[model samples]
Target chain A: MAETVLSSGEKIFILHGIDADFRNDGRRRCEYRSMEIETKLMPQTHGSARLHIGNTDILVGIKVELDIPHADKPNEGKLEFFVDCSATATPAFEGKGGDDLATEISNVLIAAYQTRNAFDLKTLCILPHKKCWKIYVDVLILQCGGNLFDAVGIAVKAALNSTEIPKITAATLDGGEPDIELSDDCIQLDTSNYPIIITLCKIGDNYIVDPTLEEEVCSTSSIVMSVLPNGKISSVVKLGCGSIQFNTFTKMLQMGEIIGLKLNKTLMDVLKEENQFGRQRRIFGFLK
Target chain B: MPVDQRRINGPEVSVPYHIYSDFNKKSDKVKHDFSKRSDKRIDSEIRKIFLKTGIVSQAKGSAYIEMGNTKVVCSVFDPRELSNKNGYCMQGEIYCEFKFAPFSCQKRKIHQQNAEEKQYSLILQRALEPAVCLHEFPNFQVDVYVMVLDNAGSSLAAAIMAASTALANAGVPMFGLVTASTIGIYGNHYLMDPTDTEEAICNTQPDNEDDFNHGIITLASLPQHNQISEVFLIGSIDTNTIKQATEILTAANKDICPVLQQCLVKTIMKLHNEKK
Candidate 1:
């Protein structure tokens, strides 16, 4: 991960701040930074969204393509997660330097969405054992403030929500071959059950949500948990060099569930409010 | 027939895709018109540029430049201790990395840097080395990274301009600033700062073997030094046409040099005021 070196004293100050239930930005341990989201910004893609959480800016674009379903799972579609860490975020991510981190984040996303109830791939199936909608969720990290996984997950959800898949109007068998026709109407995806990840960084004895670069440097370990809207934990992954006891790990998981639920609720509310604006929603990409 | 397990599989859709057909129709309609480009700019006019410095707070210096829809961000890191040591070295090394975002182009780019990106990195390094005073930072290395947010056209030229401005913003000693611009030659007409579509149309080779008068020329130069640092040409064109294109690119670079100077001045003034 791209990070800054924090001195011991600075680390102690952050630990003390967390112990008091207050962070450097004057927020509670569970509080999150203000986020700005805009959807359908990239006209080229079927669905696109730009998200800013503090300084970690992410752009997610979803492209839907037609492909043959797997033989084992002929009725299900496919979801692919691709993460590109832009060199502008840090010099450490230049060229192939960021590939390892990108693969790690993408793997976590794939695992999060792999659950049966997390995302229904059957809805994307156009025809059994034939054509299906393959959704490609490409995430671009323009800047890294901290807490990248959570930011990427939220942006992916927003993009997937805004995605409009072309409706198949007609399918027929002509001369022993299947033929498909696409309609002008595009159907908006139902992303209500999409999973959102929340990363809790352990600083000293307590865990904090949304660790900044300095706080991340001071953290010994972090737990990333993906929570669905129905309060189901889809996946869990631990990062950093620090180890946690089994009891502490269980507590961390519980804390993750609580914070993840809150984050999802707020995210849904924000998306709902933005949708109410309809076509009048202003798009401010990186210009802002 | 056996399935190819090595390649990622997808749902098989019918032929004659609607999206591709729509794009083809749109382009076919524009192929005949030669009066002006699609964006309503004349043959010689360049797109409007929006340039800013110090956009990345973490980097020592950074710049973001947008030419119409083309967006490029370049960041310069502070001088760091060189990892490779081979005897005594007098001049510092400069490393350049160029990348295009997955969704920057019409087609989605992969996470890894492709062959074209690596080639552009080499070109950028050559373009920037002429301007930087490398000997000042002995036993250290400075890294410049350029990311293309949106690739409309003239991305290399835009990267060159952004990287040079970012170096100046970082307070790196340099002989002069480098400005760059690209021109597309189609038949007898020269298109300045062509967009992606225009570039494709210009670069497309005709089926007939007799007619081959299309190419793209990118020129990076120091206007004060009156010397060209790098020239990247693709496709095929006559020598005379190449000369004409170079002149046009040089003039465009001259036009853009003042804008770059103004941007650097604004960044320096901001830094100076912050110091107070």
Candidate 2:
């Protein structure tokens, strides 16, 4: 990506403002822009969600398929994540141009879900060594304005929360041949307590919660932290070319832990309240 | 399309309102029994149709079509130049991607263009070929991305409807409004706008895989001139049944033309109203 040059005076002004704990947009250090979340937006996916955080828009769809487990992990289920940085996000992402970013973000997801506490691989199991449910989480990037890691993580959690799985009625095996029957009624899984991601951007002397594109350009380094319901850190990824001091890294970790706890609680509350409100809640998706 | 008379074992198979199958043999059996005309529908009957536009505002043109429970959404993009050298075609191009949302049916599958979606794209290209003025832009291509929100039945037909509406919404020059719908025969009865369930019932029987031979007729028309652009039939429909289904589809499109044109006019008016 080509860099946009800023006048020396403008750079100095922004740097000075940051030093004084003020942003050009008049937002405080920890404040975030308004966001919108819509669940079950794409009817085709078992669970789908669309989230817009500022100018960054992310859509995540969770598809469930039955598959035979790997030889090494026959008893445990599997989770795979694929990210597509669509051209709609920016002209620069046209064609295969978005592959690099897609890989980077998906790697972050892999790390986040790698830990056992973050996602229970056993919950996706169907049969001991025969069949297991594989969830393919496909994230489609529609737009980008910055702080994408936090937005994408939040959207993935929401999409997983809204996912509904078909109830398997019976699975019979005769002579090592299996026949599967599905129940007529559908069942929804509880994902309200799913993991939440807290991306801490190390700015001048402080670590900001979420950074806009401009703020991202100014930051030297950032850490993306994924936290599960029990306050356990699932994954922590450091980004940017700037080196981080040991003291700053520890401080950022503390900040992430505090923020992650609050984020998980708030997300659960919102999802529960929305579910309790049910269909009466006005449906707002892409149209809105 | 003639439904391959296959067993209805898939959890997605439905038989409540609409039945799927080739209608010739079943209609023949029903006709032999003579229990008054099945369906009690008029010769010019049409399935219940509903359309929603501006559903995907991010796209330049978008529309959603629902024929009974069969629902499809299409997004239209470009007269823009092809970004890739290999992705271009001579007579203007129509790049279509169709996918069934994992939750759209009983079994949730990964997101990819499946064999079924590929088949539909070819059929849709055939249906819209005559209606679209592809010669206008020789090197440019129009991409249509259709996602099946629900798979009750007739998704291709609904996709056709959605695509046409999206083109109009995009202000693409067209001869006129194009609407496509499917009609089928079950036993001795001719059913209009069969749902996925109805489609299944039409395509099945108690014993064998007879529904595979069931005939399905899909008709796309300009509706104003009574000119048919595409008429597809699967299974075996004798000359008379074909004529009957064609007449039914043609007349239904004829009736819907004004309504469809009125929608276009209303949308245009809204655009102008906003400008003013």
Candidate 3:
């Protein structure tokens, strides 16, 4: 999260700009900032992606391990989200200062992926009740300009798209205990149903998507929604310390649904196009 | 040598006995009768509520509420100077702690707050922040603690209502009183103020691909101001359900406002009589 102290004049200027459907960066109300996405950059992780939107930057890495399934959910695998706000993102985030924001973002992600339609955990299950694959999605906030949730959401989906889960070659029950063997073959996950988040910041009488840091300071409240590719909303959370009329809240939900579907379609297309290049594509690290 | 000696510890891999019991296999899986609940309440009918104020003497203000089986007690303390190492702020802050007793739920809760409890605390703080007049108590912080003695369903909504009353009881200035309600949506049925069982069922993924909406929504609103303070929705639900759920929840909030106002009035009357 980025923090800024604005004077009365500056606040009014930004508010008026939003009211007239023009943001500080000249983008329309619903238009998002152009994002740059790179996948499979880190060799240590099973899947890795970096996304940059305006000044906000997020890096997502996914690690998969074999573990026992939960007692209640024996047939399903687990998806755990852990967010680490690096000190480089902001000085205030140093030394456990960002725990609250980290928890909130991770909780939202967990709720977004909770539904089976969004991301099926059954596909990750190796053996029912005995063994399963635990996919750990770790998000690192390298920089925070504004709209951290949406940036992280995009990065996570891209990373999951590039993930290659090692396929099981053989399995058998030996002496009432399950024994499994792994092959060199790997299978890609079905990321088509993955959900992406859309954040709408209510400024003045209008709502804007992907507000910058200065614009975020002028807003009263914002809504963060996770929408699947099928246009179904998985979860919605209202953020900030302000309230809005019930009428405006419903309007925001509808707007978010439309924007989320467009963003999901665009992101999937981008990932698919990138995948077509295969391993021949040059990897882009932090360097230009 | 690394073990903690302060308290007793259970086995490393202790499984609940109910998991092994055969009694729950068949009977528990029986599809619930959507027509009538176990308590014979209709789908749209909420459970009876009992609201009271000034329950705790040690705190500045307190309130206790019960909705069917869920019981929650909330207390608010006087504003204290901000203790964190932050710069001067224009608006005061509110610190909310939401806790559940070990025996509050069917499964025993731990001493420390879990992830779900932490999320609930954050939501509770956000829901109450908009209703409070923080500018009046600038440079200070008000602490609110909510304890769930028994959780049957809609505990978060219950906590929100109780905390709002506690804040009002402490004479915190506000634009309007805050009221909250929860709903469980399953396909076409909207179960207002769902019980623990119904809430679980609604939150799960649909067994068949009927494309029906399902989810749980918890909303807090300021009735007099015509504003929604917080909305926490979980599960895959469509926009239509959200539109309908909000309307129903808004009406539910309005209905409970009068009950809260009456309780507050009674508390004030007793205080005035005692002063005489």
Best by DockQ: 3
Q: Comparing to the true complex, what docking class would candidate 1 get? A: incorrect
lDDT of 3 by residue, B231-255 (tens): 9999888887898899999989998
Chain B global fold similarity (TM-score) for predicted model 1 against the true chain B: 0.90
* Native contacts retained, all candidates in order: 0.00, 0.00, 0.75
Which candidate ranks first by lDDT, i.e. highest? 3
lDDT of 1 by residue, A150-265 (tens): 99999999999889999889977777566899989999988877889888888898888888988999986677767777665665555653444434555666777778878888
- Candidate 2 residue-wise lDDT, A116-139, digit = tens: 445657777777678888889999
> What lDDT score is found at residue B33 in candidate 1?
69
lDDT of 2 by residue, B83-137 (tens): 6654455566666677888778655644555445655665566556556777777
The CAPRI category of model 2 is incorrect
TM-score of each: 0.53, 0.50, 0.97
Off by over 4 Å in 2: A1-5, B1-276
lDDT of 3 by residue, A153-237 (tens): 9999999999999999876778878899998989999998888988999988889999889888888789989998888888998
DockQ of all candidates, in order? 0.01, 0.01, 0.57
Clashes of each: 6, 28, 0
